[model samples]
Target: MSATSRVPALAPFRVRSFRFQWPADLATSWAFEMETLILGWYVLVETRSVLMLTVFASLLYIGTLLSPMFGVMGDRIGHRYVLSAMRAVYAALATTLMTLAFTGALNPVQVLAIAAVMGLVRPSDTGMRIALVGETMPAPQLMGAMSIQRTTQDSARIAGALTGAGLVATLGMGPAYSVVASLYAISVLLTFKTGGSRAAPNPGADTAGVSAGLRTASGERETAEAQPQARFPQTAVAAGDASARPSPWRDLKEGLAYVRTTPHLLAVMCLAFLFNLTAFPLFHGLLPYVVKEIYRTDQTGLGYLVASTAFGALLGAIALSARGGAIRPARMMIVSCVAWYAMLLAFAYTQHLASGIAVLMLVGFTQCLCMITMAAMLLRTTDVHFRGRVMGIRMLAVYGNLPGLLIAGPLIARFGYPITATLYCVIGLAFTLLIAVRWRSHLWRLEAPANTR
Candidate 1:
């Protein structure tokens, strides 16, 4: 049998770089899940306050505003180098936490302080990882690669959530953090194995796929008015190109100006910020509160609840990978976002553990489908050079989460879980529809360049 028939799932591994990158991404995400759960639980139990837990969680996203700078750094240096350095920092911080926990010096205050340091680099992780994949993989493999990449995170969430709860329960925080530290070290090692001493690949100009420049919803091709006489290099060949040697600020401005002119990209950012604001807070940081107060569960129950989403998302990522390019990302994202919000609405009213898990599974499933498609859509339409910076700007959308989480604490305290969650999900569903309507030509149309098959 040919390679495709022999092992379709492993096709992305044919590239030496991805072979290393995949494992590295997997380990890093696994460690992150473990750390988040362990620390979030500690903060909640110690302070006995949902407000403090939200503050701790919000602090973790402090680096999000600086994501564009991280992208610019990746564009100047290699993403692999940037990633290696970042993972190393992760290892170091994990070790510091382990030491504090072991010495009986670990407290919520100390945890928050350390988490602030970790936050300075964590939010940029996904953007850099995507930029690396786009640089290393061929265009034909982009969908499959993104799908597989998402699988690492989805699977990690399942593994990490369950394992972290177990480890902390049985062995206590110090020993549990030892595992997290070790995983970070493995991630750093694997990351160093990628990028292979060669300069990053240059994908040349924007693909003929995107070069059509403008398409009406009816599928007619037209030139856009703001379309420049020459398209910027899609994959910036930065290392040796004399012209690529401009100031980082100039590069940032160029990336911004280009994105501002692109209607689809602007729409994508808006949708991203919307989801981060209205949807993510319920599923992520705020879930701990929901578990303790609403579901009336301990940390193990919290683990199961969180893993339910991961398990569902893991299945969705696998399905997307198996289907490959058959799914158009932009179309899928809009549909899934609507479904995702609906699931959140279901989750808000859930009280029993079994029913809560069931609702969260659907919530997780749809959330993963929506986010992976959004990321793939961004990577697919954006050329390589700008991909990093574009993704970096995309990271800025995550800044919405900070405000969302901050708002959620008081709302939960005053208005209660069901009412606050209902408000959030309803708003998300309404805005998702508005976004689809607002950017119909760029996002809703089948033949739009943003939906390139």
Candidate 2:
């Protein structure tokens, strides 16, 4: 068989709406990364405070705390609309920042305030966009679609980091800020063009009682793993009465309860949070500190460091996407996690610039692979109806980096960058070892062909 027959050429791209939406997603991701690079550099230059970096990083996720609620909102109101609306707001915020920069009025406090506000809108955009994948492609092609999605996202990060690094280095922050704002505006327009932009009928709003029960049963049972035992009494979907159905708050509670009770999902949730706490905070918050405090890199050097890691991420995502369904996510996930920790440990001891960037590149590769595996597992196993809410919870867990930043920043300030990095490396390794021991049986078996259930 030909490679095209064996691996498939990203079938999701055949859909016109998805074609547009995918690039839009890329642009948004690109803009976000660019902002991070520019903002981190700017903050460091202005205040010379690692604590401020921690506060800035933490603030970026403050809005993510409401991710579960936004997921519920997406299910009720439609993801496309939610995404488009938020993108519009994001565009405005970026424009405001750009204007401030151009007028020589931008300051750290102003950036922080805008970043916190922007954080509130970010969850809605991300959760809704991902959840919409179910609407865009057939069930069997979901893995390919998700892979392509991740590829674009990672590629954008690479591009954004380099572009931000170069721009800030050359023309300063104003022009870079303009580019970020423009990307958001483009995302807004693209998302508005996508179809299936209507609100989903509330499960209880229109269906008959018997049908509501059937829908609930099917949603719960459709995943590869089935747990028929009701750990929490599920509220019946009241098809006839939208007003009588459980409120969004209640739905959020049920979502939490569902994840807590579902072994696979609960495992995914815990590990995802652990990853954010250990690896990602290091990537976002600590790396900037390391570059500045330890190496004292200029803009070009800083850009190259971030870009090297991003390039590795881009390459990893591309490989995973091209292999498509041939790769077992669970096995890759385990290997990637182990490799990531090892690379991180090596990174801590490195003092040379070339060696540091190379180690960081490998670290990025493993981290990207691990994330793709986690995301694929979560998306494949989650019920369609609860996709938004589940993704919201997932994002919330990922934002565990906020607290992680709070902890790591102080540690970096007190113990210095190398010791702090070493401490996190040890913590991550120990955590990974525990997870491997406890979940060796089932976690690595996830997405494997031998066991369908």
Candidate 3:
């Protein structure tokens, strides 16, 4: 059978809203990656300070920590308007920053300020992901949709990094920023094409008027009449259920409570926290340094390194797509995590550029696989109502290692690369083993739902 014929036809891609959402996600990824490379390169070139680089990188993560409040607002109002407004703000901010850079008026303080403001808009990015995915596809096709989303994101990172590097090398940071700003504009346009109504509020809003009416009615009525009413409080309860409910805090709380009680999730989060603290900082800080020092290269080489990892990630996502089952997500996570650490260790120890590049490709593949597994597990385990909030908190936990980024450069500078890199890999390996051992039972739990069978 032909490739297209062998695969079962799932759903028509003619759904206009779904078509728009996919491209919107692609644009968001492209713009985000472009901005990251541009800002990091601009800062390093201008200041030559690793401390400033760390601060610049931390801004987005700091912004991610505030996502839950935005999520709460998304639940209270609607994600449609929130996403649209935020994308507009993001475009405006990028344009302004680009203008300043082009004018040669951009200072370190101004750059950092821009980063912080950009961070504030980061929650909308998360909110859009939740809203778009929910609006675009049915539950049966959601996993495939998510895989596509992840692959596009990784591809964008690769493309953006390469584009940004070439732009910076030829035209300068100003033009790169301009390109990024234009991508954001395209993203906003795509976002506008999605169609969906907002979710209804919870029951609490409806009861306020009924409660007032009861108080007035009770006061006006005689004690004998009120006695029977008081005796039948079930009527009041039924009325309350009809009321416009409070926001989704209870749903958020339920997710939080689950993470607190679920040993498996807790183990995963702990591993994630440590893994992020060590590996993420190394990528943002030391990876650039490695390109500069070990390879005797420039920003373009850094871009190629990033692109290599992204290519590996694309391959890994494709493999996961081929195996369309939800078996042992946690075990997959553990194995990927271990593989990621081993690759990083190899990258750190290798002096040859080709060897380092090969190791980084492995690192990228395993890291993304781990992320996909974790995302799948989290979604399957949590309730639909609470998924957004749980995802929000997960974002917070995963990036909570932001402060450690600050220490990464300083540690490398002080202790030297070999010592620092060895310490990181050792710590990462120990934690991975510990988590795997402790959560072994939970990791293997793959009780298929009746519907899937």
Candidate 4:
């Protein structure tokens, strides 16, 4: 059979709306990843303070913390408009950074301030991904679409790191920032191409029981009874029910309540958060240090290490794409976590450069597998309405632990990198193993039926 014939059709890609939005998603991912690499390098070159680097990392997480509120805003207004506006904000920030660099007056304090401000606007950028999924695709294909999105993100990180490193080497940081800004502008233009730009349901719709259940459940909120309510009750009830007005706190509560109540879902989120807390700091903080210390190399080598990890992530994404559907997500998660820790330990202990590089690739591969499996599990278990808020919470866990990165630098400075890494890896491996054994039955359960409501 031909390669095309061998591949099963993915419903999300066939949809016109999703196809239109794909370019915007790809551009945004590329630009964002490039900005991260450039920003870190810029700050390090200017100040050489690990504390400032931690602060920069913290700003990203702090921005993600505001996503629940951003999600409510997206639900209140149209997601497409919200996405467009955020892209413009990111573009402006990039332009400001470029201008500073051009003036030869860019300082660590100024960079930190800009990064934090940019971070504040980041949640909407992330929320757009979940929103686009709901607006464009059918239920069954959502998992496949998510896999594709993660793959695109991983690919972008790899491409962007290489591109940014080349640009920095040739043209310096000013031109690199300009390239990132231009990409954001392109994303804004692509945002305009998406169809079905309607606001999601508000809280008042929930109390009236007029598609409230549907809104709280999956993407297909339109049940048989929803048609009448959509036509008649929407106007009258919306006019009378001031309580239905969108509230960020209420939305947060709704999401938290779902997490607290759902056993498997909560387990997945908790495991993911702990796993990230232990592992992510190594990537964002320690890996650069490792390149400098062990490889006896410069910033370009750091870029290569990041690129290697991204390449491994790309391989993991391709594997998921080929498999289609949820492929033993929980079991894969546990196994990947164990392997990731082992690789990290190897990276710590290995003295030879070639051995270290091999360990880094394994680390990248296992981390990608663990992350992809966690994402798939979360998406599959969450109902459509709750997906935004649930994802917002997940983002908080995934990104909000900036303090870990902050501490990682100090821990290495005091105890040495190898000992610090070994300590973390051992603890993380033990914790992951414990969680997997304890929650095995709950973690592997399939999604509850729609009619279970």
Q: Which has the greatest lDDT?
A: 1
Query: Candidate 4 has what TM-score?
Result: 0.84
What are the per-residue Cα lDDT tens digits for candidate 2 across 1-453? 644456575667766668788988988999988988899878878998888988888888888788898887776676777788888898999999999999999999999999899877674565667777755665556667776787767788778888899888888779989999999999999988775532232222111211222224236522112322221112223233444455687567656756665555676677778887887777667678778766777766777787788788877877777775676666677678888988887888787678878988898888888887776666666655567778888888758888889998778767877777777778877887777667666566654321122
After superposition, candidate 4 runs with Cα above 4 Å error: 1-6, 9-11, 195-243, 352-354, 445-453
Error of 3 at 280 (Å): 1.9
Off by over 4 Å in 1: 1-5, 196-244
Q: Work out the TM-score per prediction.
A: 0.91, 0.86, 0.82, 0.84
The superposed Cα distance between candidate 1 and the true structure at residue 203, in angstroms, equals: 7.8
Each candidate: RMSD = 5.1, 5.9, 7.9, 5.8
**How far in Å is the alpha carbon of 121 misplaced in model 4?**
3.0
Each model's C-alpha lDDT?
Answer: 0.84, 0.73, 0.67, 0.69
Question: Taking the tens digit of each residue's C-alpha lDDT, what string does model 3 give over 133-211?
Answer: 6544555544455566678788998998899889888997688888889988988888787766422322211121122
Count of residue pairs whose backbone atoms collide, per candidate: 2, 2, 8, 2
Q: Show the colliding residue pairs in model 1.
A: 235-385, 236-385
Shift in Å, residue 96, candidate 2: 1.0
Order the numbered candidates by lDDT, best leading.
1, 2, 4, 3
Clashes of 4: 2
Return the lDDT, model 4, position 359.
68
Predicted candidate 4: what Cα RMSD to the true structure?
A: 5.8
lDDT of 1 by residue, 6-46 (tens): 77766778888998999999999999999999999999999
User: How high is the lDDT of residue 26 in model 4?
Assistant: 81
- Can you list the residue pairs that collide in candidate 4? 204-244, 218-384
